[model samples]
Each structure stands twice: as C-alpha cells, then as structure tokens.
Target: MTLRIRRRRFGQIAIATAATTALSGFAQRAFAQRGGPILYGVTLDSTGENLIIQALNLATGNILPINIQRRIEPGERISAFTAISGRFAIATGPRMALPGRRLGRRSRIISSTTEEIPEPQGLDNDAAFESLLNTNDNNLLSIISLNQGTPPFRFANVDRRSGRVNFLSDVDLLPNRRYSNLCQSPRGTTYGTSLGPDTGPVLVQFDFANRSIITGKARILPIAPLSYNKNLLVNDVADLALSPSNQLFALADPTYEGTNSLFIVNTQTGEMTFLRKFAVQKITFTR
Candidate 1:
C-alpha cells in the first residue's frame, strides 16, 4: 500500500477537504492588525502533466488562479514551494537527470514575482533536491537539502534582495533526523517535525537568532497518531504551516493509508488536537 502524493522540490499541491471550523477570531484580528487580508496559495493537480497554482483569500475564501494558462512539463513540475513577504512566492521543480551524464539529477528554484503574471524567475543552483523551504518576515528564504548520504543535510539562506545564496552552519545541534515539514512562526522561531528512530513524530524548534534548538527550554513534543478509519492512518506529515499568532497546522498522511488529516498542535504543551480529516496535501498561511 503506497499513498503517492506530489513530490516537488520546494513545491506542493493542496486538495481541499471537509472541515467546519472557521478561522479563529483572534487570528482574524491578528491579520487585521497586520494591515491586510490573509491569503493562501495552493497548487492543484490538473489534467495531463500540469499543475494549477492559485491564491486564496482566507477572509472570504475567494480564489485567484495564478497559472491557469501555463503549461508545465514533466521535469518542470513543482515539488515544494512557499509564499514569501505576501508579494512573491518561491518554488522548486521536479528533479531531472542531467542529459548525457552517467547518473546525475538536478533541481531548480524559481520565483513567482507576481500572482497576476505566471512568468517565473529562475535562481541559480547546482544538482540537489530542496526538501524544505520557508521565509521569514523580512522575506529571507531558508532552504534545506533532502538528499540522504554523507552530510545528509545542508542549510542555505537566499537573500531576496541581492539574489545571493549563502550556505549556513552550526545547525548540527538539531537532531540528526530527516525533516518532512518545516515552517517559521511569526516571531521568527523555526519549527519542524523529526521522524526518526527514538524520535517518533516529534516536533522540534530552533531559535535562528541563537543558532540552536531550544533544547533545555522546552519539553519534547510528539505528534500523536490518528486512529485509522477504513485503513486511514496518519503516520507521516506531508507539510506544515504556522499562523501569524504562531499556531501550528499540519497535513498528516500515512505511508500507505486510506485518507489523510489536518492537525493543529500547541508547541508549549506538546499536545496535538485533531482538527479535521481532509485530503489536503499541503497548506501554508500568510498575511
């Protein structure tokens, strides 16, 4: 049993599901104070080898399509992506075998400069799959590698202003486990899920300013497994998003199960509250 979902480097798609609880009033007030409506962007799988990227207004549920007229080829498919600074988005495409090479693959990152126009700006990069991506309030891009081998993970920061990419160090203080989901809270703390031996579905936080995980400060938080409904079990997290008020939202899926679910967890308590059972593959929040 294999549950296959979109695997785009720095890009993903979200399929809507049924959930009744509306956005919280406190969250709404937070957005209002931020001076704009909260908008969400999603990439929907469409017919043929293409994806439809669109933006949704969280306040009114109004959706605006960004790439309805664009044609995406197989190698050009988006693997993972995130919106940055409320004005632009950065996305990565599928890995491709370098032509005429013995055995090598390369991935690329592009930016959606404007929602109205689908033209993307390509950023320079070598051959490595970008597994995770997130942006801070200052629009600084954070990217990490998903490749599994010697020095399995590497972190880099992309300066949006100068288009300069800088490799980072000193994050070895974090658990040496694979991270499936990563997001930044409004206050600038980085949170991600670590799935590894002895770790279980653990939520890990890092203080970028301090360049270390808040190890001694917070207790280990683990994501609880959902009871399978008709073979639906959420054992793996596909993606994560953080609200302006620092609420954590996760799109959890099983390796090979019937259905997926959305969960909200409080980092302080390490308790996860099941929010809704939906088929949404990925989700993110912005204001």
Candidate 2:
C-alpha cells in the first residue's frame, strides 16, 4: 500500500476501534481512572487539504477529533504549537511563500477571543517564530525565533494581554550546536533538542528563567539507526512536548527516508521508547 493509504487506514482503524471501546464504557473509565492529561496532535486530513486537531488519550491510545473556532488553511504550515491558559497558541506561516519574503507569518492565541502576536522589531522580515511555551504569568508566553540577529537565535516573552514583546537574552553561542524545538514542563523547566555537525542529536535541558543551559552537553539519544533498503538514520527532531506529569515526548523524523515516529524520551537517562507511528508535524498536550 502507498504511504497515504497506510496513513488513512491507520487513522480509520484507530478512531473506529477507540470508538467501539468507548461505547463499551471501558476506555472512558480507564482514562478517567488514570487521570492523565489529553495529548493533542495536529495532522492533515485524508485529502491533505486541511489540518485536523485530534485529542489523544495516553492511557487508552484512543484518538478523538477536536473542534476549533479558527480553521487552518491548506497551504499554511504550523511552525510551533502549544497550549496555555486553557487555550491553544499556534505559530504558522504559509508554506508556499518564498524565502526572505513575509507572507503574514505570525502567532495566534485561539480562545473566546483570538489574539495575534505582533512581530518583534530588529528581526528579518523572513524570521519565523519556531517555539512557544507558557511562562509563570498566565498572560506572558515564552517564544524563540528561527532567525534573529548576529547569533541567529533569540529568546523572548510575549504579553498576550497587551500585545507587547519583551526581548530576553539570546541563546548561548555553542559552536556547531543548534536547537530545533523547545518545550517546557508545568513546573517551569524547559528542554530543547540540540543538533550538531559532528555529534548526534542531544536533549539539552535549559533553565530559561536564567537564560542558560543546565546540562552543559547532554548525551546523545539512545536510538539506533534503522537499516532498510538503505541505512535510514534519525537525525532530527521535528517537535518536542512534555506531558503534565513531566514526561518528555518527541516527534522524531529520519534524515532522508522512513516515516516520522513518536517516542517517549527519558530525560534522566537519555533513553527513548518508540510510542507510535506519528505522521503529524506538531504535537502538544492540552492544559
């Protein structure tokens, strides 16, 4: 079967089986007893024309579609996604736009009232917001840019209530090391994935409050390379998320071949466990 067919079949089987179990009343009770936070993932529909948000039950592995007020267009790409103050904050840009061109790339907080985050000054017109996390204050959101000035990466906080941007310190100048995505736990500990030219992917813990890397140089992920028709290597992480209970999860993508998969990452031991085949681009846990 083709990749699209496999993905459609997977979605169908997951939803149908979950629905059946829910009707039987076992899955719902199990989920409630566990009291785990619902993990949300964003994926394309079967037609690949629109994005669909689904709520995933970690305990039962059941997926249910979620309805949002704002409809994401087909050509728009979600660069960053997260939840704060019981609402969804999404950073998106048009995929068809040319490089160095601004095509209305911005961040939006969706709730009873939709708010747009203003683009900060001194950044290139093409700079895109790549990561978002909630701060201690409900109205302030921590964000990072894909491209900034000299060092190329900047960390800042956005005030959702007043539409103000407060520039924080720039990311540390680590030679040959770059961060791809960022996520924070409910207790305010932030983590990121660091990539380098000579080393494999490492999970770097950060104390964003002080704008420093806590783990000087984290160990490489314990994921082995998959050998298929050719050797397929997992080289990059597309997204990272932390559950309410502080479990680190990653959407790992192969460098050249193979499909994206979700993994449960152990922060202390640098170990990873394959969770499921996730073809989605973004995943976040509901608050």
Candidate 3:
C-alpha cells in the first residue's frame, strides 16, 4: 500500500524574523533548547525540475546540503518536511498506479516514504505514515503503521542512531485501531492516540531498557477531538499529528463529513479543542 501525507520545511518560522526582544521567549526556547546539534532536514521543493535540502543559519541562502540526496521519488511524492534539533526529516506519500495501469495495486509494496537525517526515516515499502521526528538524548522517529492493509492503525518506532523500527508491542500496538496520531514531548518521550475504531487517542510510549533495546508501552490516555464521528475518513486520520503543546492538529479533508477540522488536545489532561480547518487544499508542514 502507498503511504499518504504532506511534507514541508522550517514551518512558517515566526521568530527568526521577529525583533530581538519579541523573539526572546519563543526563539530562546526553540533555538536554545537543551539538546545536541541544531540542524534540521527536509526534502526541498526546487519549484520546478529542481529541489534540494541544505542547512542555513537563517542568514545566507548558502544551502549546506546534507550528504544523502535523491530527487523526489519517481512515483513517490514528498508532502511534508520537518527537522528535529538539527536532524531533518521528510514525509512521503505514494503515487499509486491507475487501474490496469502502471504497477497498480498488485505492486505488493508499501509506498509510504519517510526520510530522516543519518538516512531515510522510512523505507520504500515500509508503509510508514503519520510520523514525527523526536530530538533529545536520542533522536526517535515516531509513526503510525499501515503494514497490515487493514482499517485500524498501528504504532511503530525507529532507532535514531540506526534508523531501524520495532513494533510498539508484541501484538501490534493499537491493534485493529484506526484514525490515530503520534507526538513527542519536551521530555524526550513520545505520545500517541488511537483515532478510529471508536476509541480515544490512547497514549503509547517508548522506553529504552538499555542503550541497545527499545520497548513500547501504553496507557489509554484520553483525548476528545471536540468533534469526532463515525464518518471521518479513517485512512486520513492515520496521517494526523499534534502541536508540541499536546493540542490536536491534523490534516483536514473536506470530502469528509461533519466539518472535519484540526485542533489541539491537552494530552497531559485528555482535552480536545479545535485549531482550524482546511477547505479543499492539502495541509503540508516542514521543519
């Protein structure tokens, strides 16, 4: 199955342009956070026939390229770009083949493409989606899984150093679940919620027993979307995410019923509040 989502870069950076005083609060926190490198990566859009990613000091257009580079995947399109501390990442969606045309559904390969610094965050067929890059003691990649080709969504993890993945649980985390989202906090911890299958955003967490092993555990944390119904396009929620504040924020698809809007949820206290909604176009975010 081909993965679906958006990719963007540096996100509409607000502070870099703000005056020295006005920028102190947000900028100090964002740029001065307690972490390692301040680098970020994203699959850049060259506008037409040209796209590349490079590091900048918010000054010169120097564009210091990261070692790994690849034109947007042939059939795979990049939709979102983000960076953690300094590691850059890109979200990718599949370019499905038409009926009886191209590879078609019989391709038998997962197309969701996620790229991360050090290497690709996701694989050509890992079928990865609804992902986020975590930057702290160890860079962690969080994402929802479509590996089963089923309705409910599943959770997966990647080793920041090796770019390898492990199931959240022995029995696919959030098994038979759907319409889910994931987010990491300022504490070097990751949080997630089960979207569809008629359940709240259960909190699935990652734990490292030793430097070499990773284990996922969950606590059915509660979250309300302020407006969730049976009609939400389950597949799309699988591409959902939240702000650093635990507020719910997801890509909105109008084809969906009940005025599907993106909002913020207070994960610390299972509360849902509407953020905004999209009309017809798709919402893409980049670090």
Strongest candidate by TM-score: 2
Error of 1 at 276 (Å): 4.1
In candidate 1, stretches whose alpha carbon ends up further than 4 angstroms from where it belongs are 1-41, 54-72, 93-105, 114-134, 137-139, 146-151, 161-163, 173-176, 197-199, 211-235, 255-260, 269-272, 276-280
Pick by lDDT: 1 or 3, better one: 1
Ranking by lDDT: 2, 1, 3
Can you rank all candidates by TM-score, best first? 2, 1, 3
Better of 1 and 2 by TM-score: 2
List model 1 lDDT by residue over 44-94, tens digit each: 454644344444334343343444333345544344456554333434444
For model 3, how does the per-residue alpha-carbon lDDT over 116-143 read when each residue is reduced to its tens digit?
Answer: 2344444445354445544344444444
Please provide, for model 2 over 1-287, each residue's C-alpha lDDT reduced to its tens digit, 9 standing for 90 to 100.
Answer: 00010032233323323211222133234357555566766666666544555666766565665434345555456767776645556666445455786455443333312444444543445455566665444434444444431125555666665545666543353544555566767776667666666665666666434422554432223233222224333465778888878898888764333667677877765566777776677788754
lDDT of 2: 0.55
Point out the worst 10-residue segment of candidate 1 by lDDT. Answer: 1-10
List candidate 2 segments past 4 Å from native.
1-35, 46-49, 72-75, 94-123, 139-143, 146-151, 170-176, 209-234, 255-259
Error of 3 at 124 (Å): 7.4
